[model samples]
Target: MSDKPNLEEVTSFDKSKLKKTETQEKNPLPSKETIEQEKQAGSS
Candidate 1:
């Protein structure tokens, strides 16, 4: 219910103007194979 900016307005703004940065994820998510293995292990 707060006065947040509209999605339409936000999307219309130019993103190319923003600064770019080279960054890596500190904690990356598990791969699909790892996830499947974990799920199978849990279900067993």
Candidate 2:
């Protein structure tokens, strides 16, 4: 079968029932202090 739905399916979909989720940061970047410490340790 094709990946895309038929025109009838698209037209019959309930858009109002869809939900919205909050934006989240799963893997945040290291802070400036942490980065600087890593650099100093590597140079030593």
RMSD of each: 7.0, 3.5
User: Per-residue lDDT tens digits of candidate 1, residues 1-44?
Assistant: 76986698777899899999999999999999999999999999
Report the poorest 10 consecutive residues by lDDT, candidate 1: 1-10
List where candidate 2 sits over 4 angstroms from the true fold. Answer: 1-24
Q: Rate the local accuracy (lDDT) of all candidates.
A: 0.92, 0.94
Clashes of each: 0, 0
Q: How does each model score on TM-score? A: 0.42, 0.44
Instruction: Summing lDDT over every window of 10 consecutive residues in candidate 2, give the lowest-scoring window.
Output: 4-13
In candidate 1 the C-alpha lDDT for residue 41 amounts to 100
TM-score, predicted candidate 2 vs. hidden true structure: 0.44
Per-residue lDDT value at 38 in model 2: 100
Q: After superposition, how far is residue 35 of candidate 1 from its true place, in Å?
A: 0.4
